[model samples]
Target: MIAVRRSETTLFTSREATHDNDTVALTHRAGLVRQFGSGLYGFTPTGERVRRRLIDAVDAELRAIGGQRISLPQLNYSGIWERSGRWESFEGEMFTFENRDGKRLCLAPSHEEGVVHLVDGAVRSYEDLPALYYQVGRKHRDDHARNGLLRLKEFTMKDAYSLHADADSLDETYERVRAAYVRLFEALDLAFVVAAAENSVMGGSASEEFVAPVETGTLDLRHCTAEDCRFGVTDESPGWASVGGICPDCGGNLVAGEGIEIGHAFKLGTRYADAMDLTVDGPDGDEWRVHMGSYGIGIERLLHTILAQQSDDAGCRWPDGIAPFGASIVPLAYEGAIRETADRLYRELGAGETLLFDDPGQTIGERFAESDLLGIPRKVVLGNQFRETGAVELECRDGTTRYVDPDEVAAVVSGTRSGD
Candidate 1:
């Protein structure tokens, strides 16, 4: 069985960042429901489950790549944009203001400028080349936003930038990160395609977007049916025949689809270094503009897509991988013998992972529906009248119901494979 979270902790807190396991994360996600506000979230239990899972997956992947989230101020450095020639173009869309010192400042739409400036302040030579710095933090945009969390004015982003000495080193890290992004999305159980793309708005020569195919997507993808090819994304209007060579996995024909762009990686090719005067002395003692690459993933968008992909009429059936609570246990009867037995079983099962024990006051139907809407994967029904002796009712959201012994839950949990 996929390991699950045991409890929730404060966001960006030292403990939350350090606890990388499954159970604690689910509890963490369960806690997110409390903070979701009027502008961005509707707060469905299943949605929270999906959101937590996606974040956990990406956070884990970034750690594997030697990255971590770091906090910086929400506003700073108006001159930095002017130095980069972005000050005018970014005018309205940037959340700008004058600081107490009368210096200009703005909220960051992207972290490239901030990261570059920070590194420039820290490094002075070849030894600092290939320094990788990343942060998963809140970002803001001043544009109109109404697409749920998919397009929010303020959201969380995981952005990493690598500074390199040689083009070869940059390329190696580039591909390494591409692979990392693939695995990150895969861990979240998202179907995605890394497409060759243009830095149309960003004005870069090299770039690609990791897109997830969703009905509400804004980007397009083309893939071929040829037996030997497996390409899916291109910036130009190439027909499927040209872009897709074959389905590398099964040799099946490939097709084109609209995709929601979620993550991206780009080669800066000294663009930002030049704009910001971020250069380091080379081995020959010559000043060299550091080769740079920027990679980003919208953590909130992943949450949105996860919700769109797995939820249904009854509610969400979040996979065990991401569910905040492994199961929502409801003791059907409250008084006398049943309550006592159920309370005992709940304590026993609670020992496994995070558990939201629904007390035995609501009717059976209410309990079941609430559990369904809450989208917890498994439901343990502790009713004294269970026809079977020495066993409680175990129900999976994926239409699995069984009268099972409480002690055997791990075995049954192991058998499920629906999601997250």
Candidate 2:
């Protein structure tokens, strides 16, 4: 039942940035997002719908693995970070401020320190080991944020931390979370690579990153071309993407490309545990440090990555699972049998996140054009086709059209969920 006149929509146009990435331009043109500052944006209703769908998909995967959802404060006391030895490391890059009482605080760039502090006193013995907790919240940093959603000063992240008593437990949970990330990207219909990576600020021994290959990415990597080989590496790795660009495993020539890093996981054996002095009573009645691991996925980066890879000159082509609306009804006229049939279909099937109707006084051509720009997966026209015959014209994002009964619209659109 959500209908809007295109003229009344508060969509503002945006100018291109230094990188010349058109996602910013196209997204603004579609009325999905607006920029208030250099890397800060406000999501319009249409953009927020897509963002919600993406988060829902991620949350479902997290809950499937027994993850306890929690919320952490965005403002954090600097004392905790000082204890972790990261205060000096993040000196200029963190948003730090001091109050009149000389109490120092900073906007949280990541919550590893905060999360460890929360679990510091909750459990006391080995039996309380292997705790898995996660939170979806805003993370802030003062770095040079650019390139639309790929890089931002403030962005949303789904960060999960697990506390284990032994390396075996940590290894098991790390692999589980990695597999869950694979499922998440697959659900979004994105082709991605899980590459061996360095644990830069997120310290650990074994680390990996989930990267999506796109033209607008800044991270460099070389991948193997062998059918069974799935190896990928960053430029920081020694002999990685070597002068000959040879694959280490199969000795085949490698292909170099840039990728957007969407998710990162680290096997932090005692990084945080030792720093925070967190320990538990072991089976031998001795104090033992807890093994820890952290995993994170950028929410907005996923949205922009999908647009960078899946869009064409015509406009974006939203994957069925992440599309704002599953379908749209564009009737040729606003009156007579056309409106009547459109209304009936809207009531029975177009309700919820399923449908939208462009009912402005513009011509049918304008309505169809805007539908393409919005990237709606499916479109139904209750025009002369429905008035003359009982068949409604159905149009797909691919420009294919078909005539079907009004009653069949729901089944056809709902069936797309399976393929998505």
Candidate 3:
């Protein structure tokens, strides 16, 4: 129950916002985010609450699948990149700088090199064949940073690395991680598609990207419509448009749609192992290289995509599992029985954990406006009807409303109680 007073909050004024086809204008107008620089934004109290909810959902999904959470240094030594043969190739896009000691370093845009080095020192025997490590932290990139959270100079990423002794083991682990991502997105109530992807700079034989369609997205994918078919490929592939968007596997016609790429999984095989001489004692007493895979979810980009997909003329409509607050308590009349009923309902909703108590200083209209702006899934209003008929009105973000007893408001919002 997070208590909030509209008067005390510093939300973005309408005049301070500019409309765009993405989340920039809506989020700012609602006072959820504030722009600090190009591709950089600051989350307000309300925004941070939503962000944490998203992080918590992803973190739980990762841990449930044998992923051990670990933190690595953001500033990495250039020696690591050089050993991996990406130092020179990545020069134009790596954030490189020299320290006072003349030691070369760069903020890691990804953790392939770091993960390989860390795992090399930890696992020395075949007994540690299958190790899954993950970290949720900040990653820096030299991207041109555009389209709100779609691209940024700095962002948060949940990256998981798996080490295996054989190709079969790597494949199994990759599928498991991919399934975990499916669950994470389902929990977030995001509709997405998994499509074959190019490995590009992250040297690997195969890759797949999890994408969600949005009007302002930059990636275009052509998907097959054949029954039980899941084939989707990037539009950049040669002859994709000329083939009438055909699915290579099923010979089905493809339909093209634009989507924002949220997650990617790669089968890295022995690229890093061979480059860095990463090895362990095999079961037969011979040294063998490890097979690896990398999985990543762009935290900020995912959140922005969700908001863009779920938002409407009102504001953000967060899914139940990731909403900052389950519901809001708006008291139409600040005094008399109305306030009493509202106060009782607020306390019943766990006193700030599951419900938001709108400030009484604002008018009913003002409270409703703020309530809609924040997009709380359920809104309990104690107004004239409550004072007259002893029934409070429950309004959903979708504009559905019904009257219910004040004592049952909390349970109703929490999905524990049923009926009007």
What is each predicted model's overall lDDT from 0 to 1?
Answer: 0.65, 0.79, 0.80
Clashes of each: 14, 0, 5
Q: Write the per-residue lDDT of candidate 3 for residues 267-304, one digit (tens) a residue.
A: 99999999999998998999989999999999889888
Model 2 residue 186 CA deviation in Å: 1.4
> Which of 1 and 2 is ahead in TM-score?
2
lDDT of 2 at 135: 89
Off by over 4 Å in 1: 1-53, 99-101, 221-230, 234-256, 351-353, 357-361, 384-387, 410-420
* Residue range with the least summed lDDT across 10 consecutive positions in model 2: 10-19
Runs in model 2 deviating more than 4 A are: 1-19, 226-229, 238-244, 249-253, 352-355, 418-420
Sorted on TM-score, best first, the list reads 2, 3, 1
Q: List the residue pairs that clash in candidate 3.
A: 1-352, 1-353, 1-354, 2-352, 245-254
Which tens-of-lDDT digit does each residue in 173-256 have in candidate 1?
888888899777766667676667776445455888777766555566655445334356644322333545455456666676
Candidate 1's TM-score: 0.80
Candidate 2, residue 46: Cα displacement in angstroms equals 0.6
Query: Candidate 2 residues 318-351, lDDT tens each?
Result: 7766776677788887677777777777766645
Error of 1 at 27 (Å): 18
